[model samples]
Target: MTAAPHRPPGAPTADGTEIEGRLDEAVRAVRAPDAVFALSQDGRRTVRCGGTAPPPPVPRDRLRYELGSASKPYTGLLLAELVRSGVVCGADPAVVHLGPGRPHPRRSAITLTHLITHTSGLPPLPRDFYRQGLPHWSTNPYAGYPAERVVRAFLRSRPAHRPGTRWRYSNFGASVLGHALAAATATPWEELLTERILEPLGLAATALAPAGRPDTDATGHRADGTTPVPPLLIGGFQAAGAVRATPHDLLSFLEAHLRPDGTPLDGALRTVQRPVLRRGLGHRHVHTLTWFRHPTDHGPMYFHAGATSGQQAFLGFRPDTATALAAVSTRRHTGRDAFVATAYGLLASLPPLDRE
Candidate 1:
């Protein structure tokens, strides 16, 4: 963590070297092969520090990192879009999109809200998902688990709790939600996401598949920082954790949450910010979409973190402070990784510069 926040040559910053130093320490502590950290306040001043994987080449703001579970918030945003568009109400049953038919066990009970809030009572994944993925294990666990299995598990499985009865983080629920949204909109899950959220937000660099983004690639890496790790391919669980994007794109997305406009999705964007569940005593410690809120002395910060086989990511924004932060790296975690800790630490340390 000794390296100063080394801003890439041409990248500019309004923040002092101390701010860059705070961010620099984290990137060093994590020893990421490739990484990016950016902070914005008052929607104007922005500063970024990047870490390169090996040598001569440097990490750029546009270098894509697998967003993993952080992508879930985007899924949540899409859910809000569907609700605002009248495709399905928050409380409507998932069966609503399955069309007219005798719904499978508990299928009629799961709602879009349940899926987004991770309270649908579904398991983390389908039963056979591992059977299909294990063979690919350290390779691409998700490659064989395709759209068919996602639909199969979602419809056939029975929920442990009546919809909305309990809160459990279920990748299966998020995955099913993606397909359900696609069904309602008559589009594929990826296409629906791109049209509704990515394109509108101008996250042009994000991609569901490696082939989709051909210009560059940041393959996931092991803790050693050299052994390449295969990406967690997007099978049917497109809504779960299969998206990748650059720090520049994520900051733009975060900026939108802080300062909304009179766009087509303003209503949906607003919905994504408001909390619905009482997860803790403070107003900020609730869940909205896939974002979890944490109260800071400065303000409440809404954020989420994600991990793939070889990548880790964090996305957080504090509305009361109008500050947003993001960090990503090719190096993955094993238990309590430094990257995750430093991200949360930075968020805690950054009291809105203009809050006074």
Candidate 2:
């Protein structure tokens, strides 16, 4: 349970009121048990919360929700930071830091850029994932797949296409990238992320599962809104989908990306936004190192959405409008759920504001 709210939903303004109403409608539309909507515009922020009781008036900042694949962007940023700091280069082979293994013939072609851009030709998950995850498939599939297992599986992986020639989303590739970064720095991914990104950004409420404050963790629920699901523990596949945080902390993260000029990771922040690959029909969709780049009247909208067995999150920002959004729900995503579309629509609805 959360504490009492210090302020009403959203900020005390016309725009704030609108945000509150929109968020309420969005949450209800999806039948989310609990949800939070956070927006940061030119550094100003508004937050709205809703769902079943303890009710919509519950404190917005205390609850931490699983971020799922949205964690990839953080891994992407770490890669960029390492590159910018000369710790590694985007062109470096992923196998260089993946520890000793019989190198794949195509290993040299799969660079950090390919891995982060989803051009590595790796499958969506490790070859052995289903075998290991079968029992826990519905609740928490990645729970027991350790790093050694992941490494062994990767060494045996045979992609149908050559690396960097195809754009295929791969949790395996992302997870390996996380392992590669950890290997390169001789530090665990969680610690490296905390020291390099989270701590610097003052994101005290963000961390890997079973860490941070347990009391603030949000309960994940199925579509029924009655059945609760256990926390998702991704084990070695953590980098692919294990990060969690309060809406306030996630909004701060987007704000940093929206305005990265003076930060310690400014170089890396800017690096993640530079278009890296273009795909989709006629090559219309664009991907940056960390986010999906979609053209809008207001420059480009960079965003990512992720979900676990029982929670969903959407993160997006438009630098031209100086706006960022972080929306999250405790309910698992269903095909018909409007949570993501609604969040994207809300951000898209905001007009471009004058920038300095």
**Per-residue C-alpha lDDT of model 1 across residues 1-356, encoded as one tens digit per residue:** 12222233443334455667777777777778777788877665455655555531334565677887898999999889878888778887887885424555566778888988988888888888887777876656777788867887776787888777778888888888888888888898888999999999888978887753324556778877788886568678778998888787888888888766745678787888887887544543588776888776645788999988788899998776567888888786877678988888887666545322
lDDT of 2 by residue, 1-356 (tens): 22221222332323655656766677676668788888787677777787763643336457888999999998899889888889988898877877446656665467777877888888998767888798886688898898878877766777668998888899988988888888889998889989988998889989788443436778778877768888888888978888899899999889888778678888888888998888889887999999998887536889999998888999999876677889998888887888899889878777533232
Model 1 C-alpha RMSD vs. true structure (Å) is 6.4
Clashes of 1: 1
**Can you tell me which runs of candidate 2 are displaced by over 4 Å?**
1-14, 53-60, 211-214, 352-356
Residue runs of model 1 more than 4 Å from their true location after superposition: 1-15, 45-52, 55-58, 99-105, 212-215, 280-285, 354-356
- How high is each candidate's TM-score? 0.89, 0.91
User: How many steric overlaps are in each model, in order?
Assistant: 1, 0
Model 2 sits at a Cα RMSD from the real structure of 6.2
